[model samples]
Target: MNFDASLWLIFILIGLATTLPRASFIVLGSRVALPLVLQRALRYAPAAALAAIVAPDVLVAGGQVEILNPKLAAAGVAVATASLWRNPWLPFIAGMGALHAVRYLSGS
Candidate 1:
């Protein structure tokens, strides 16, 4: 109920909440199995999580939507480069090249 006691309690709860989900597989071992559908869907979790993180940065600028943004075009170029070739570095290089090219041309 006191300030220090409540703070410590909240910290402990937060730590437990964070640790439980990550540690569940190890603690439960093979005894518990996720469903087949869930297992299949989990394969895209990393890509989904990545998109969730990268999307806002790519699509937004100046805290607002700008259709002509260099980053937006760079993202499109990167996606296209990724689709056209299997090399991982091509997309990065293409995206960065497009970004710099647009920035230089637009003088922005």
Candidate 2:
């Protein structure tokens, strides 16, 4: 492999971008206060991000819409199994098993 100056520059830019916001928070913490509305909205950021990441996978099938997917079904099963069995690992195993079972049965 060869080292490229452009690649290094790109990496440097990415690192700077990632660090600058965090550094800004530390450097300007006392000088600034997050707006109340913004803070409230920020509180939902994780949920929004999780939905953004999982919603598509759990809702989409083929090129069309499918509100009920194997993953979603498996999640339901996982939640139920977890609650009933009270085992953390069982949920994961059951979820995967349910998803695979659906896939196998559906032949998709």
Candidate 3:
């Protein structure tokens, strides 16, 4: 497939935008150390990012809380699996399996 010139430019711009901040940290971190408070706070970034990514998908659908969302059910299964098995892969497998099982059973 042939990509248009504008599409190529957009792709390049997006790559640069994403790469620049990460590269800047690596380049500048050697010259300066971030404050201790900021360093501690940054530790939460992954959990915060994960919650930001997941909360909406689990709790909202069609711009509202979907009580019957299969995702919610699957998330519960995943959480339970994670708590019980304490394995990273098991939660993901359980979540996807629960999601598919719910969808198949409900025919939706």
Candidate 4:
């Protein structure tokens, strides 16, 4: 398949847009230290980002909050597993197991 010039230009622009900001941080971080408050705050960034990415998909279905969904049940199980076990892998295993169990029981 052949691509047109505009498509290639758009792809190049998107690649640069995605790469530049993150690259800038790494390049600049070697010389400049982040503020103490900012560094402390940034510690929560990964969890916050993970929640942001995962919450909607887990909670929402057909444009509504799906209280009875298997995903919701699985999320609860995952959280509980993480809290109790404090193991990263346990949460994932429990969540997937819960999801499959719910789906199988519900026949969906």
- Residue-level lDDT of model 4, residues 19-82, one tens digit each, is 9867876978778776999889978988999999999999998899989999999999998998
Of 3 and 4, the candidate ahead on TM-score is: 3
TM-score of 4: 0.64
Q: Predict model 1's lDDT versus the native.
A: 0.92
lDDT per residue (tens digit) for residues 1-108 in model 1: 448668989999999988998898999999999899998998998899899988999888999978889999999999999999999899999999999999999998
Overall local distance difference test of candidate 2: 0.84
> Positional deviation of 64 in candidate 4, in angstroms?
1.1
- For each candidate, give its TM-score against the true structure: 0.67, 0.62, 0.67, 0.64
Go through the candidates in order and give the C-alpha RMSD of each one to the true structure: 6.6, 4.9, 3.6, 4.8
> Which lDDT value does model 1 have at 78?
94
Predicted candidate 2 versus true structure: per-residue lDDT over 8-108, tens digit per residue:
89999999977996697698878888788988987897899887997777767796777667877887887799889977799999899999999888888
State in Å the error of residue 26, model 4: 8.2
**Model 2 — which ten-residue stretch has the worst lDDT?**
59-68
Model 3 has an lDDT value of 0.90
- How good is model 3 by TM-score? 0.67
Q: Which residue runs of candidate 4 sit more than 4 Å off their true CA positions?
A: 1-31
Measured by lDDT, the strongest candidate is 1
